[model samples]
Target: MLRSLCTPSLRLICKPTTRCRLYSTPAVPKKPNHALGVQNVKPWSELSTPQKVVVASKTTVNVGVILAGVALTGTIVYYIGSELFGSDSATSVFSDAVDKIRKHEELVAILGEPVKGHGEPSRNSRRRNRRITSQVVEDANNEPHMFMRFYVEGPENQGTVMLEMIKNEQKKWEYKQLYVDVPGQGLPSKRIYIERK
Candidate 1:
């Protein structure tokens, strides 16, 4: 019985079986033809009238917008510069007032020599570039008047300076009032008359 079982199992194990197909093999990819795949771009002269017009209009609009933006930026900068740093602006008035204060015998004596003037003080360092407090308004006589205030400091003490000016018949700035107020200095704050109207 053992010989019979072994002989049959050995014959089945050693026998060759015919191959059967289940799935087909994938086809190889063809080489790309660069010359056939390339696209032909038309020249400017070959473009249609509508295409040329569209391109031209797009370029014109882009250039116009750029020029307009530049012009606007320049106008804004010029206006702001004239308003802030021009010879006839509020900043000019502030400079003149500070110069007068530096020369005044009373103020110089109280605040000490080499006095410096600046705008309002702030706790934040970035806000130190404060603008001068100023205003331009018309008076009852329809004459334009400018009012300004700023701070001044010296080796001895710090004080606040206030001033007012009017545009005269010649359109020139004329000082009406200028003064410095020093608190805790034990003296009356005297109004320094720069030029009496």
Candidate 2:
């Protein structure tokens, strides 16, 4: 049995293959290809007219959108700055009136010290969100006039301030009427005239 197994093993080991085929070709080294290489770019001069038009349109649209955004931002900033800090704006007028009210002896005595000014009252507890009501209208003489109303509060009492202004020939705001009305205090709702036309 050992001789038979050895004989078969020797024969198998000594056997040679009669048929064989080569499946691989010779190896050849090649340079790597980059997707974004300068060699891959097509110059503007080489582009067709239609392709050029498309590119031009895209650039114009992008620039137009950017310019529009900048203009809108500038307009909004100018409006807010002028409204809040301009010398002739309603907010400036309100601040000036409040200062005068604070200096008045009668109002200070009745309303107490450290008076605060704010917009109209609302249902919300946060008064900061309240907006001051104001309007611009033309009078019978076709002159522009502004009317505004707000509230002022102190430790003792609160009152509503009414103001009216007219645009003068020099394009300046001139106070026509300014007053504070304190109601429900068992006193006459006397319109305290702070300014006259």
Candidate 3:
């Protein structure tokens, strides 16, 4: 038993004289050689003419789609930039402001009043001294408008003015509201609105 254990390979074979040749299993088939490291090898047989034509057509279609997409994107970008930054859009608000003043009859009536051109605006002197100055100019729309600068001369005064445009049934313009520019705070800019005392 010790001898048999010592020579397990011999015991596994049918006979020692046979040298395990008769009992040995068949060798495994050799793996086919793969060219993992080789380069420039044909990966597949050449495509048939019809297959080639199909591939070419697909490539052409893909390129055309890509180009069309690029063109469309460029066009959209151009349109957005032009509309947003164009002079017309930039000037529209200023023009609208002027147009509102010019078209509104009430606004004209208010601003047209004869205050001494050099005199400060009528405001309380105790709370805060106020100096109101105005100038007329044409806006982008070529409409007459007024630019006002106000200085608050006292500590207690604050003011602001609300300016808006209102059109009548006939589309005639009017200034809709008036408010205060803070006394002596920010630079005052108001569309002139005058009320008869």
Candidate 4:
């Protein structure tokens, strides 16, 4: 048994050798056009109508929102500026004070030192000219301090009035120099400076 294990067996050496091979079809060459891997690109004009509409609507909405934001920001700035810088905002405040003072009998009686001007307003008031023409003249120099001139077709203050008013420490306008430059209703242009007596 030791000799048989050490030596090769004659039956095993007589076996025939067999070889195995794998066969496959050759790969075909790719098309010349596909070799570069070009992609289809469409121009903007070639886009469908629905796609164009969607793009246009998006643009319009974005622009509208931006415009609305600008307007709102402007309004807020104006409000804040009017309050903070009340000096230049005298037109509204002074005009309103004039109106309020006129409505009060006690305050109107306190008005003193009237003005005398008779020549058809001198045709000098830019307000009178622009108002009659219904046109606006951007001339701040034309308007005087605390002076409001506008045209109305009713029996309002027909003539010019110069008023001397002072705002108290409490932000209240006190009638100081409330004199009419041009008196309305053919009333006296100059009023006697009333003494407290």
Candidate 5:
């Protein structure tokens, strides 16, 4: 029994493997006001249009109304998509997620390093019984994946950092895979695969 308990724990160090990081991606700045889910998409055929015209204007108006409606609907759908998934064409999720984890300062300190990036968050990791904020999404290459960055309070009272990214939709942040600069962990970070404490 003493031998089993006294066995040295294996210490495995993971290397960072991507160009993204907590402070490198462009995510929305933490804001007092924020946008959440989808809005609305109105159909075009229901719009008001003249029944008769001088040169078959009814068809033209109908077509025009349909197109306009489509455009409007498309815009709404896109907005909702981005909100649910992530920003359509920006990198801000990192910043947002980091902020939520409560290690903003540590993440910021690592940003100045020249060789830093996000890593995989552990599978079942936790700190102080709190859930870590995580998200997984593909890189700019359109790959399907995610990278979860976890923040925990260590025994020394310092912040503990870990990252993980999974391609499965079962993971979090499947929609938004972008990164954001934060002030928690160092740059060139990787994800971990631990469980909740």
Candidate 6:
């Protein structure tokens, strides 16, 4: 067992072969000859002042172009996202409902009544608090419905005029109901009925 673990004799190890010369050579780095004249061989740190400035300027311009391209792409993405999600365009359901209500001759004539303090805001500026406020919600039938209230304070002092409109299959809005209570009187004077022809 001891003989099996021991190294072989020097006579067996001393055999001459091509493999013996592999380890005899020492690795040495070859020096580059300056006589061939490599044009860009000089390190950046060893370059003349003008040469270094030219390299640095080119690097700065390339970096600037890359940064500008990223900024422009980011700006385009932000604008597209804003227009897609944030705009109240005519195609939007809520905006369509509001536009229809605003253009209604009957509703506009009622709400557009000139109030006493309306022109007084901002020293006769037209930017008065609007009389109408509205919201849209889906009913039990999953149909779009608009609920709106108008504050009409004139000679009659009409408090809050409630209007409810539902969208039909023809892409048109029809009034569902309307309620307007008399200012001094406790109960509504009349009930509005919406009957389709």
lDDT of each: 0.79, 0.80, 0.44, 0.44, 0.43, 0.52
Which digits, one per residue and each the tens of the lDDT, describe model 5 over residues 87-142?
32223544444444434444344333222223334456552233345554566877
lDDT of 6 by residue, 25-144 (tens): 344576766688644467987989999999899999999999999999999998777545653321243343445444544444444544221211244455675434567789898998
TM-score-best of 2 and 6: 2
* lDDT, candidate 4, at 183: 44
- TM-score each candidate: 0.70, 0.68, 0.30, 0.28, 0.25, 0.33
List, residue by residue over 1-197, the lDDT tens digit for candidate 2.
Answer: 11112331232222134433223334557565676463555789999999899989999999999999999999999999998999888789888889988998787777788999888788878556678888999989899988999988899988889988998889898889988887658867655667877
Collision count of model 3: 18
Cα RMSD (angstroms) for every candidate in the order listed: 12.6, 11.0, 17.3, 23.9, 36.3, 19.6
lDDT of 4 by residue, 1-197 (tens): 11111222221122135433233445567555655786564676997999789878989999999999999999999998885565535444444544644564433443432311222233566543232111122335452223333311113343343444444566554444443343434556533321111
Global lDDT for candidate 5?
A: 0.43
Worst 10 residues of 5 by lDDT: 1-10
lDDT of 3 by residue, 1-197 (tens): 11222232333433555443223345557565666554343323576777778878999999999999999999999988865665433223333444443454543443442211112555565643334444445667665444443322122332333333333456444444433333323555443443211
* Candidate 5: count of backbone clashes, pairs at least 3 residues apart or interchain: 56
lDDT of 5 at 23: 24
lDDT: worst 10-residue window of model 6: 1-10
lDDT, model 5, position 10: 36
Candidate maximizing TM-score: 1
Q: Roughly what TM-score does model 3 have, to 2 decimal places?
A: 0.30
| Per-residue alpha-carbon lDDT of candidate 1 for residues 53-87, written as tens digits (9 for 90 to 100) | 98889999999999999999999999999978987
Pairwise lDDT winner, candidates 2 and 6 = 2
